[model samples]
Target chain A: MKILIGISSKKYSEPTLDVGMRIASILKSSTTILDVGGKINEFSYKDVSIANELMESWDLDRPGVEVLEWAYNYLIREKYIEKNLNEIGFSKNLLVDKGNGRSEVFLKGVAVKNLSLILRNGDIIEELRDEVQSFEYDLTIIGGSGKRSMAHDLIQYIDSSIFVVNNFNLKQKYRILLAVDDSPGTSKVVKFGVRVAQAFNIEVDLITISKDGDFSEKFRIASSRAEKMMRRSGVTAKVKFSEGELVNTLVDIAGDNHIIIMGTSSQSALTKFFLGSKPLDVMESCNCPMLIVK
Target chain B: MFGFSERSLTTILFWVTRKKWLILSFLLSISFFYFPTPDGLSSEGHRTLIIVLVALSLIVSETIPLPAVAILILIMEVVLGVDTPDGVASSFMSDAVFFIMGSLMLAVSIVHQGLDKRLALLVINITGNKTWRIVMGFVTISALLSSFIGEHTVGAMMLPVALALIRNAGLDTGKATKLSSVLLFSIAYGCAIGSIGTPSGGGRNAIMIGYLAEFGMAEISYLDWIKMTYPMLILEIPIVSLILWKTFTPSQKTMDSSVRKLKVQVAKTGKLNANQLMAIGIFILVFLGWIFFSPIFGLGIVALSGVFLYLSFGLINWKEINRNTNWGVILLFGSAISLGIQMKETGAALWVAGQTLTYLEIIFQDVEIVRWFVSVVVTGLLTNLLSSAATVAVLGPIVLDMGGNPVITGFMTSIASAFAYLTVVASPTCMIIHSTGLITSADYFKAGWKLFIISVILLLIISLFYWPLLSL
Candidate 1:
């Protein structure tokens, strides 16, 4: 499996890098880290510096010269490629021929690749969106500063699956929550969540929230089915039901270092999901990482 | 509808879920037409009552969106011959409505400038590690800003600060600790209380002010309004802090780690830029104008000029303002004002007040204090269900027509309308806090009833002590 991590310029997020390492190592996945210089790079290339520092810290014996050299050259080549593309009446997008392709590094026995690309003063969010779609990534993880805009922008365009992590702790036992309901997307959400859980070797809890206990029977059936699906995938599973609004219930259930994989197209959440309402609502308050699957 | 085939079952459920409100609306409209007209009311007044009954029912039930319910009121008023198009149009565009529109625009512009980061720095700087102190910091900052900048904006800005504190607290919402409740409730309740402190605090204040002027009262100046209300706010802040502190007593004493993280979070926000400085300057200028010159220019014109300055100074663009400003809320306010004006014009308000006043007068025997209590209760109850502005628009007219002190009645109704402590849908501030996804509607009910009772007691105490001294 292939994992994609987009590291931003926000410092003091070493925990995000650690989170990426855990996910890659557990799934035995080939992970690619794209350290894109965001809006903060205009004043300073602090994003590149942080990426280099984290890379060197991750692998002490592997002299960091090769990674830094590759990263610097990649930045230079990216600029030249963009100018060449503009000269041919073909505007440059980060999706194709973007990033420093030569920059690749390994992190603690995990096959890690680092691409230091600068979006440089344009719509960095849009540029990053295209860059993420270039790979058929099974899981795309992005570092954030616990701001609503960072998670909201990435969640708006979900190609396959995405995780927006903020202030993640380095040493923590991650809890996995599968937020399922009777939506068209639930089956996909359940199967994908279970597969990821099995890969990460984590216990999965299936939670369904009903408003005023009106959907107890339906939630029971849904959680039961989800539990069976997870069990078949060789992942430990538990089924639970509570009654409240969906987003609020999830917020109440989420613990530290927990990853919430939610199905947005449920009966109560369908309309709000289309409006880009519930995901951001949950993200703004939920202290843990979120993997929203459509 | 039960025991049906798959497609038939789907069709049945669809109708029951989606179209039930439409059916209820139709039945309600037909039912109200048959409602008996009250005594001493014109035929036009009776028709207005029918429209009011339907509109209020739909709004309370939430069968349709609220603004749509308000628009339907406007449409039905014309269709039922309660008022003419020209009269309705003029009523819809009052100075009070313009003030609401302009204040909402100013709020959106202020929030868009990213000044909340600066506010967060100030709040966290004051609240270093002590859990109780942090709670007070949030309350103090929110109360101070919401008095001038409006409650909804302050609520929206202060919401992230509280949430960040919760995250740093490492307290899980699943456990639902008293500490968490203390933090979240402080922001919501602070915004609610502060909204009553100044003329610009909320549209309901301006609505009451405008109503008093139109109903043969001296135009209450901005400073005059502040003198009447700020003392009550001064009394309210500590009382509110005590209420929340006692209701949700924290299990632990200190939040050392969370406090440290808060300091770091404040430091991380960096410095304010030019746009933020200009936004703050514009806001201060507007606030000062409201304090000094609103009596001369009137509050609405002064507020409108501030929004014009926000535009001309390039602090915020028209598109951002247009996007952030809720036109639906403005439409709802306008239509509500139009309906309120109609209720006053056709003697609907007087007739309604007359019917209720008969019973109260029999009990109180012309006692002004007892009549004021009834007015406050009625306004408070209605405010819980409707927006404060809508509550003031509807009930302000009826109570002012009740023939007591118009200024006192206006003040009472406006303050009581902000007594929306019970429901998540009670006020804009409550709604914004609930959007944080931390507190549930049930949690609201749990804490709300207590605050409601406390707020009632506080209002009466102020009425007893301050109202007489100020001759309000």
Candidate 2:
């Protein structure tokens, strides 16, 4: 499987990348880190002027050189990203295309490619949309806050399943929570979650939103199918049902869970007038990371 | 939720939200049809007035897409019998609309060619990195380029340059970074001021020229336009620059780092590619054509020819041009011209002009200065409300009839219309800059009023001193 990990800004934390690295190594899959740098137009004089004073050139009209230089030194030479890559036993290579440039990094246990994209002057969402559409990825990872948490808004814009990670702890074992509604996509979400949990050698605790007496005959049928799907992967699963405001109840139960997997609602006609998609709302006010699948 | 696909529901919800705005515009427009044909209006004038009112509501409320509103104007004109179908078609498209379309296409093509690295290299080299001086650097480049290439193009070209500089420095956007505000506004206000400089600067200027000739006046040459308005444009630039510099006092003092980065960025391109040189060559040719042969070829023809040259030279591909060029804006512009022409032909413009003239006369009692001032004030205000060109289209005939030295009246209307400072949608240039998401409407209003006051004073001085010196 191939995964696209999104670094919202250049100043991303190690944990986000670490999560991708761990998952990739565990599954022995290909991981691509897309580092999104804001475009040239969005930057002020101060951003490009990081070097002491200014560097004056007479060559006139070439672009991508100075930015490439800055990214090289900042991300590679300064050992900013290099040391981080080395710590994870990843090999880095300078990737250049004529005047424009990026870097490709590979980890030992899995195939990892690093790409730096500077948007210049367009919507980051659109840029990501185009990038994702350009290739196929099973899932995409985004940090929980700032532009990365844009994973919330991006749920509608992108096609792949998304995992918005907040306060991710590599030191702790991941306890998976699969939040399901008796909706069309619920069984699919649970199936995908179970596969992920099986790879990590963990169990998935399936939670459903309902009035909660007997977990409903239909809910039992849905949960039974999901448990059987996990059993196919030799993964154990448990089920719990809740009777409260969906987002609040899920967030409350997510404290002990390291990752929460939720099925996306069928996006009703009135959804546009409302706050946000159910998956994003749960992701926003939650205690841990969330994986949203269709 | 049970049967509908998520995508289908999203599409439905999108249209439903749009329907809300469309419904509001529809109700507001129909409500005003019973307004009993204001005292002096002809029946056609009343119908035209009803269309204008509806157009205004749609534009202001923005319940539908702007292109839809443009189409609505054309449809309303024919349905209301303002003109024959053929007449409406001919009226919808004019040299002014042609110029706007051609120039906008040209702008998108130029930006697509990625020449801003060269522009950035040149600017940073000259500006020497003091943030304010660098802001001035962008100001000078934007204004100068906009004067010839038009603001939409200049604004587009400059957007990435400013963003590169800002993001390179790691400054936050959305008002947290004053430097971001200054750099972006310099482009916005620079485009605004320069757009008033020549006929090529904006669609409004060309539309005004078309109006002057159509309203039965001696033809105003492109150079004659430069002589009449360029000085005022020059005068406004410093005031705009000062206001931007003052209002967005940069949190950082020096931009040496950004300049250095820009220098590196420029160097990365190595040497100019063939496409870059071809783009430059094409722009110079177009600039010379607009300047030397606009009277013969028409500015619109010259601009459209330049677009063909770019295409033929293989400097840009058809797919790229198609993606970058906004056909909707072109349609909107054509409809504006059509609407303006209908306003003139239907007697609605004269009636509106006469009523306005009466009110102004009552207030100022036949003072010539007050007439010009009113023309400037009313056009300026309207320009900020709608698009500058649309404002000129609506007001051009009305003000031309209010009567004074036709050139002065036309110049005041055209030049002041470029002051789209207060609102994002006021000018194409402002809207383009706003699309960058670096500044807010509050930022516009913040720097705008001060410049607006200064501009009014400056215009008064120009009317008193500059116009007479030029024998207007």
Candidate 3:
């Protein structure tokens, strides 16, 4: 599996890096950590590049390189990258221009299967969307500082399962709130939930919700199958059936303590765009981190 | 639902969201096309205005690439029957467009020579260790150098000097501080105010000169331009420096160690090499060509001559110039200038100018003030939103048609466009400083409003009390 992690700054992205790295280590995913800088308007793009070149001559890094260096330090500290590789340090000279405003540096990984750092400029959604579409990553992870407003675009446009690491507090132990439904996506969602449960070494609260307190046989069967999958994967699990609304019930149960794992809505993309999907709605309202499996 | 896959549908939806402005512009243009032409306007003028609206919205929104917008303007001019293909093509490649293209290449060729270290040493030696003196020196040197060379070239060269000083001051170069803000704004604002000093200082000045000549109004020689605007440029230097120092005054009263460290660091690069000398000598020849021979061989050809010399001397290569030059800007400005000429030919500029005077006369009650307001205030504000050259190109013909002395009005519009102090998108120099991550959008307004007001008053004073003495 390939995972893409979007980071912005040293101060706000620590938890995102930690969470993304931990999951990547568990899944042995080929991971990329990306930093998106401010958009340079086209009128001044060439001029700004000229200035950036001058800055380099002065032995200074361009705008986004510092963030990549910080992420590199994090990798070294966590030993996610090979120890000997840290000796050379994070050099801006190592950033290879892959064109279309993307530059990357490849690194040998200790835990993850393959690792690379990418730097891109422009609107966050467009850059992330382009990165995901071009790279064909299975999962794209981002921090939640400003993800609430972008949740719709992230879910709608990005061609990957999204993991928004929202307000993750390291001290608080998190449980997996694996949301199960009768949709066709629930099987894949259950499999991802088991991997996450193993990654975090946490128990799962397998949730099945209905609007009118009438849980259909298909919903019961889907929940049973998810629980069975969790059991087979050696993940500790508990089953809960709720009757309010799907987004409200899940957000309430996963309040600040549980990492919500749920399948993307089976609604058509056009419908999901005009009226948001359940995962997007939950992502907007919920306070905890979430993984919306595609 | 439309027999497409979910991924393709999402991709289409994403494109729609990203390019909503482009869609809206097309719809607006189509709707406006059916509106009856106004009383003073011809059918062709009406169509030209439609194209203008579409181009403005697209350029400001930047929903499409600039080159695409340029091509759209050319296509609309012919399709809308505003002009013939031959006329549009002729208007699209003016000497002013050549100047913009040549100057952009010249800037690339010059910057590739790496004279920034020499520039750094020269600035520090003149300024010494006092923080205030260094700030003034930066403003003075940036203003003087950018007046001769283009502002983007000067801004690019000056950034490293400012950043090196900040880094040597024991501050984190990655972080924004008052020291960094003041020093950086010095370069940005200094380059901005200085751009009005000469015709070669900015592309907008060339565009204005082009408009004046194209409209058969007046001919402004390169020396004549410097004579009219240089005094205002000189006056603005201290004012800009003082405003920036006051707005973002750092706690470090003296950058003693920083200056010493920067001097040592720049010293390690050694003295000016042979290539650097050849580059400077070629640039001086270019400046001399502008002052002495521009009238004989237009400013565009003279600047191109300098680029030729640089290439012949191997000071820069075609590959480097090709890589660094902004071809899109040249295309867009070419399109904008063509539109401006069409505005004049189709009587669109005259109609708009007449309507503006008729409406604004009620509030200001004076035609002169209305003309001045449109040329200075409106152009100033729009320059902050659109690019300065684009602002001048679109607004130039209308201002010239507004009944004042065309030289004064055109010159005022060009000078006012340099008041790009309010936003990062105002000018390339502003964006250059902003790319360092030191100056925020709000930080622009902190010092920008003061300089904006000051510059307007200064330009007014020069126009009223000083410029009449030139008797142009």
Candidate 4:
């Protein structure tokens, strides 16, 4: 599996990097860490580039390079990347221009299958969407700074399963809240939940919510299947049924302690766009980390 | 739902959201097209106004590429019957466009020569150890140099010098600080005010000169431009430095060690080489050409001659120039100038000018103030939103058509466009400084509003009290 992690800076992205790296290590996924800088206006893009080139001649790092360097150091401190005998530290000269406003550096991974760092400029959604489309990654992980429109765009446009590392506490233990339903997408969500449970060696709370407190047989069956998958994966699990508004109930149950794992809404994309889906609402309302399996 | 896949629908939605401006402009254009042409306006002039609205929205929104906007203008001119294909093509490639193209290439060639190191030494050697002196020196040198070369070129060259000083002062270069803000804004604002000193200082000046000459209003020599605007440029240097210093005064009163370190660091680059000398020599020849022979050969051809010499001397290569030059800006300005001319030909400019006077005259009680309001205040604000050149290109013809001395009105519009102090998108120099991550958008206003107000007053004083002495 290929995973993409979006990071902004050294201050706000530490927890995101820690959680993403831990999960990627467990899954042995090929991972890429990306930093998106501010958008340069089109009228001044070329001139800004000329200035940036001049800055390089003066032995200075360009705007986004410093963030990438910080991430590179984080990777080394965690031993996600093996230390090279010849190369001692992160070097700006190693960043290879991949064109289309992307520059990347490759490193040998210790736990992950393959590791790379990428730098891109422009709107975060546009750059992330383009990166995902061009790379075809299976999962994208990002820090949740809680911008509603950014969450909407990420859920609607990015094809990969999204892991928003929101309010993740490294010191506090976290449980998995696997949101199960009768939709066709629930099966994939169940499988992903098991992997996540195994990755963290944490227990799972299998939740099945209904509007009228009437849990149909299919809902029961889906919950049972998810529990069975968790058991098979050696993950401790509990089954719970609730009746309320779907997003509010799930968010209340997850609270700030559980990492919510759920299926994307089975509704049409157009419907989901105008009237947001459950995953998007939960992602927006929840304070804990979330993984919406697409 | 309509036999489209879910992924396809999402993709379409994304495109719709991203390009909502483009769609809005198109709808607005269609609605405006059906409205009856107003009295005193020709049908073609009405259509040209629609095109203007569409182009302005698109350019400001930047929903589409600039080159696409340029092409759209050309297409609409013919399709809307505003101008014939031949007429549109002829208007699109003016000497102003050539000057723009040549100056961009010249900026690339000069920057590629790695003369910024030399520039750094020169600035520090003059400014000495005092931080305030360095700030003033930066403003003075940036203003004077950018007046001859373009603002973008000087902004690019001077940025690293300021950054090096900031870094050597034991501050985080990656983070924003008062020292960095003051120094960076010195370069940006200095370059901005400096661009009005001469026609070659910015593409907008060339565009204004082109309009004046093309409209048969007046023929301004390169030196004539200096005689009129250079005093204002000189007066603005200290004003910019003082405003910036007051707004973002650093705790470091003296950058003694920083200046020493910078000087030592730049010294390691050694003396200028033969190639650097030749590059400087070619630029001198270009400057001489602009001063002495611009009237004979035109500013555009003279600038191109400099680019030719740079190429012939191998000071810079075609590949470097091609990589660095902003072709989209050249194209967009070409189209914008073409639209400006069509505004004149179709009587749209006259109609707009007359209507503006009729409406604003009621409040201002004088045509001169109304004209000044539009040319100075309106153009100044628009330059902060749209590019300075694009502002002048679209607004130049209307201002010239307004009832006043065309020279004064024309000069007012051109110079007012340099008041790009309010936003990062105001000018390339602002964006260049912003790219360092040392200054924020809000920081622009911390000092910008003061300079903006002061500059308007200064321009007013010059136009009313001083410019009448020239009596062009």
Residue B137 in candidate 3, Cα distance off native in Å: 1.2
Name the regions of candidate 1 deviating beyond 4 angstroms. A1-294, B1-22, B172-175, B361-370
lDDT of 3 by residue, B1-472 (tens): 7899988898899999999999999999999998888898999999999999999999999999999999999999999999999999999999899899999999999899989999999999999999999899999999988888889999999999999999899998889999999999999999998899999999999999988887888889999999999999999988998999889999999999999999889989988899999999999999999999988889999999999999999999899999999999999999999999999999999999999999999999999999999999999999999999999999999999999799999999999999999999999999999988888999999999999999999999999988899999
Model 3 residue B307 lDDT score: 95
Ranking by lDDT: 4, 3, 2, 1
Candidate achieving higher DockQ, 1 or 4: 4
Which 10-residue window in model 1 chain A sums to the lowest lDDT? A38-47
Q: Name the TM-score of candidate 4.
A: 0.99
Task: Give all candidate RMSDs, comma-separated.
Answer: 14.6, 7.7, 1.0, 1.1
Clashing pairs in 1: none
- Between 2 and 4, whose TM-score is larger? 4
* Consecutive 10-residue window with the lowest summed lDDT within model 3 chain B: B210-219
Instruction: Name the top DockQ candidate.
Output: 3
Ordered from best to worst DockQ, the candidate numbers read: 3, 4, 2, 1
Instruction: State the displacement of the C-alpha of residue A15, model 4, in Å, after optimal TM-score superposition.
Output: 1.3
Q: All models, DockQ values?
A: 0.03, 0.09, 0.89, 0.88
| Pairs in clash, predicted candidate 3 | none
Candidate 4 per-residue lDDT, tens place, B1-472, comes to 9998898898899999999999999999999999999999999999999999999999999999999999999999999999889999999999999999999999999999999999999999999999899999999999999998999999999999999999999998999989999999999999999999999999999999999999999999999999999999999999999999999999999999999999899999999999999999999999999999989888999999999999998888899999999999999999999999999999999999999999999999998999999999999999999999999999999999998899999999999999999999999999999988888999999999999999999999999988899888
Residue B403 of model 1, lDDT score: 81
lDDT of 1 at B255: 78
Model 1 C-alpha lDDT per residue in residues A253-290, reported as the tens digit of each score: 98665778885433332233346577678877788877
Q: lDDT scores for all predictions?
A: 0.69, 0.71, 0.93, 0.94
